[model samples]
Target chain A: MNGLNGIGVKVVHVGGNGNAHAVLREIEARLQLLVEKGEEGSIDLSGLPLMPEDYDLLEETLGEGEVVAEVHSLGPTRIHETGIPGVWWVTHYNSDDEVLAEFIEVAWCPEILLTPEDDVKDGLEALRARLFELNPKSPLGGAPSLDL
Target chain B: MRDETLLDTLKRRGISRRGFLKFCATTASMLALPPAMAAEVAAALGKVRRPAVIWLSFQECTGCTESLTRAHSPSIESLIFDAISLDYHHTLQAASGHAAEEAREHSMKQDWGNYLLLVDGSIPLKDDGVYSTIAGISNLQMLKDAAAGAAAIVSVGTCAAYGGLPHANPNPTGAVSVSEIIKDKPIINVPGCPPIPAVLTGVLAHYLTFGAIPDLDDLGRPKAFFGESIHDRCYRRPFYDQGKFAKTFDDEGARNGWCLFELGCKGPTTHNACATTKWNGGTSWPVQSGHGCLGCSEPDFWDGGSFYKALSTPISPVTGAAAAAVAIGAAAGVAIGLANRQTKAAAKAAHQKATIADLEK
Candidate 1:
C-alpha cells in the first residue's frame, strides 16, 4: 500500500467565489482600451486571489485562439492568444519550471513577443561572424563593418 | 557580484530585457505596489548595487533562517537573497570560530554605517547577558556593537521583534526585543513564528528599490504584508458570514472546510500575509491545512492565552440590514483607528525631518 495506511481520501467540489466575473469585467475594460486608443494593458493573475474553479471558469470563458508563442530567456514563458482577439494569456516560469508570474494581457501583441533592439544588433553581429567562419576568403571576412 | 549592479548581474546571467521586465512586474505585484510602479521598480532595481547584509542569530532557534533558506533556489526570494552581499551569517557563513567573528567585525567595519543588520531571536539581558554568547561575546554586547554603526536593523522573527516565548510568563533570561534595546535606528519587524520567506524578501526588495524602508504598520511591520487581517482575506469568510463553523476536528463542518472561528482561530486579530501569500510556494497555510492562526506575528502572543480558546469577541450570524450595519461599523472603527495611527506616524516623521534639518544646519 502506498503510505496511506487505509485512510480514505475525499475530494470536495467548491464553486467559484465570483472573482472570475470581476476579472473578466476588468479584462473587458482593458480590451476596450486596447481597441479605442491602441493602448496595451495587463493584469497580474498571479497577484489575484483566484481559486482553481475560478481559473477553470476563466479558461472556459476566454477559450483559446490560434497564436501560441514560447519565449526562452531566464526560463520558458508561454504566451497564448485567447479566443477573444487581442487578448493574451502569459505565464512566466523560472529555471526550475516553477511559475514565477501569470498575466492576462490585452494588446495587439504582448511586449514580450517583440525582439529587443539590442538583441537584434547582437544577432546581426553573430550572423556576420558565422558568415566569416563559413567563407574566410570572402570580402565580408574579418570584423565586418557595422554599416549592415 | 559586489561591484556589479543588479541589472548587470541579470544581463551577465543571460536574462533578457523582457525577462527583466517580467521580474520587475512580479516584484511589483509581490510588494503590492500598483502595476504602474513596475517601471519605477525596474529603474531602481537596475541601478541598485548589492548592499552588504550582516545576519546575527541570538537567543532562540534558527527557524527564521530555515524559513528564508528553504525557498527553492531561482525563486524570487532566493534571487533577491542572491542579489544581496551577505557578509556575515553565523548559520550560513563558511567561516567558524574567530574567523566567523572576524568576518562579522570586518563587514561591520568596511561597510560601517551603510550595511543592513538583520537580527533573529531576542537578546538576553539577565546575568550580564551571560545566558547566550557567541564566541564568548554576549548577545547583548554583540547586538549593541553591531547596531552602533548599522544604517538600519531588521528584526527577523517573532523572538527578535517582540520578546516571544522567552519573554513569556516566568521569564528567566530577561530577554528583550531588538527595538527595546536599540531605539535610534529604523527597525522593520518581520515577525511570525518564522516569517513568510516572500515577506522578508519583499522587505529587502522594497529597501533596495526605493533606498528606504517600506511603509510600516504601527508594529513596525511592512504595511504591504500586514495591512489586512487574515480573517478579512480568509477563504472561509463566507462560511463565517453564514455561521457555519467546525466544532471539532472530525466534524462534518470540518470535513466541508467551513470556518474555524469556533475552533479558536486568531485570524481576526492576527494581521499577516499568510492568508494570501500562503506557504511552501503558495501551496497552503495553517488555515488551509485545517488549523487556526496562532497569532504568532503579534507581540506577547505566547502569553496571550490558550491557542485552543476562542477570542472574547462574540461572533454570530447576522443577515441583511444587521450584517450591513455590522460591516459598516467595523469599517468605520478600522478607518478611525488607521486615521489616528497615520496622524501619529506623520507627526513622528515630521519630528525626525526637523531633527535632521537641524543637524544639517
Candidate 2:
C-alpha cells in the first residue's frame, strides 16, 4: 500500500484511533472463533462507517500478503489477502473513484472470484467445441506420437 | 456348485481377509454395536448369501443412484454394494426393453418374498399414474406388483419416503410415499435429496446381519442414521448458538463462515446425516461449502415456503399462533403461581398450634 501510495493517493492515519483498535479487536475475536471452530464471516466496514483513513489503518494492522485479486465487473473491487490464510480485505470504488464499499471477508477466498455451476453449464457447449479441437483425430488437432 | 458367499466375492474382488475384517469392525462401530459384536458381524457377513435387491426408479432425478455409486473409494460401503445381488436396477442395469423387464420378473419370481425392494422415487397416483410410466406400466401398478413379493422395502430418497420435490405445492401428480402405498411390509425411509452413501450401505449391513429392518423412527427411517437433525451434528452449530448468522451470501458474516440460519438454512428442521456422514467422502457438506440446507429430506419441504427465508421469520399463520400460545402459557403459569402463593399463606394463617397443655386436658 505504501509503494502504491506514491502514485498520487494521499495517505493519513484515521482520526478515530480507539475505533480502529476496537474494530481490529472485534475482527481478532472473529478470527479466533474461526480458528477454534472453522467458522467464518464477513464484517461490513460500511456499516462501521469507517473513514477512508480507517480502511488504510485496518489494512496496515492486518499487514499484507503475496496474493491479491482485482475484480472490475461491478466496480473497481480489490481483494487483498491478509497475512492470515482465509482472511481477506475487500474494497470497492465507485465510478467517481470514491470508496463505496468495504468488507473484511473471512473465507478461503472471495466467492466472487469463483465460477458458478450454472455459468459453467451455460458455457459447456463452447467448452465442448474446444474439446473437439483438442481431439487427436480431428482436423484442428493431431494424434499423440509414439515417443513420449 | 454352491453360490458364492460375501467373503468369496470380496476375495474374488482382490480384498484381503484383513481388509475385509477391518471393514466389518468399522461397520460394527458405525452401527453402535458392542466391541465383541465386530467378530460376530464379520463372521455373519462373510458366510451370508448375497441377498437379492430390486431397485425401482420413478419420479426422481437419479441422484440417489449417483450418490450410492460415488461414495468414498475403496470403502466397504461400495464393497457391500458390489456384494449385494442387485438383480434389477433401471439406471444401473445394462439390460433394456423387454429383456430388462424379463430379468426383473425372473428375480421377483425366484426370490419370491425374500428380495429387498429398494425404491427411489414417489409413486404418482394422479390420473391413474399417467404423470410417469415405464414400459407402458404405471409407477403405482409396478410398485404394488413388486411390493407384494418383497420381504422389506428401503425407500432410498426423500421422494420415495415423503413425496419429496414432486409432492411440493399443488402436487399435480398426487405423489405419495412408499408407506402411504404399501403398508403391510416393513419399510425404511432413507430420506435425503440423496442420502449419504454409507447410510444406505449401513441399512443394507443391518439387514444382512440381523435379517430384519433396523429400528426405525415414526417416519420409518433408520434411527441410527436419521436420529439427529443436520443442525445438531453441524460444525457451524456453535455459531448458530452464538446467534452469529450470515445475512447475505457475500457479506463479512458469510465470508467469515458464520451460521447460515439467517440465510434460510433448513438444518434445524431437517433430519439427515449430511452434517456427519457428509458428501464426496466427508470432504464437505452443503453448510460447510457456504450454502443453506434445502431441507430436502423432510416431508413437503418445497411447499414449506421460500428456500432463502430464515427459520426465525414467520413462514405461516401457525408460527404466529404458536408464539401467541407461548405468551399465553407463560401468563397462565405466573397467574397459577400467584394463586398457589395466596393459598399457601392462607393455610399458614389458618394453622392452630397444639400445645402440650391442651393434649393433657
The fraction of correct interface contacts reproduced by each prediction comes to 0.24, 0.00
- Once fitted onto the true fold, the runs of candidate 2 whose alpha carbons sit more than 4 angstroms away are A1-148, B1-4, B11-14, B29-37, B316-361
Q: TM-score per candidate, in order?
A: 0.85, 0.61
- Scored against the true structure, residue B355 in model 2 reaches a CA lDDT of 100
Q: Is the docking of candidate 2 incorrect, acceptable, medium or high quality?
A: incorrect
Backbone N/Cα/C clashes per model:
0, 11
Weakest ten-residue segment in model 1 chain B by summed lDDT: B312-321
Local accuracy of candidate 1 as per-residue lDDT tens digits, B1-361: 6766667767776777888877887788778786668889988986777788999999879999999886632556656777788999999999899999999999999989988999999999999999999999999999999999988999998999998888887779999999999989999999999999888888898887777898999999999999999898887787889999999978999888888987888999999899878887676789877898999999988876778768764343346779899999999999999999999998988874357768888
Distance from true position, residue B311, model 2, in Å? 1.3
Best by lDDT: 1
What DockQ values do the models have? 0.28, 0.01
lDDT of each: 0.85, 0.76
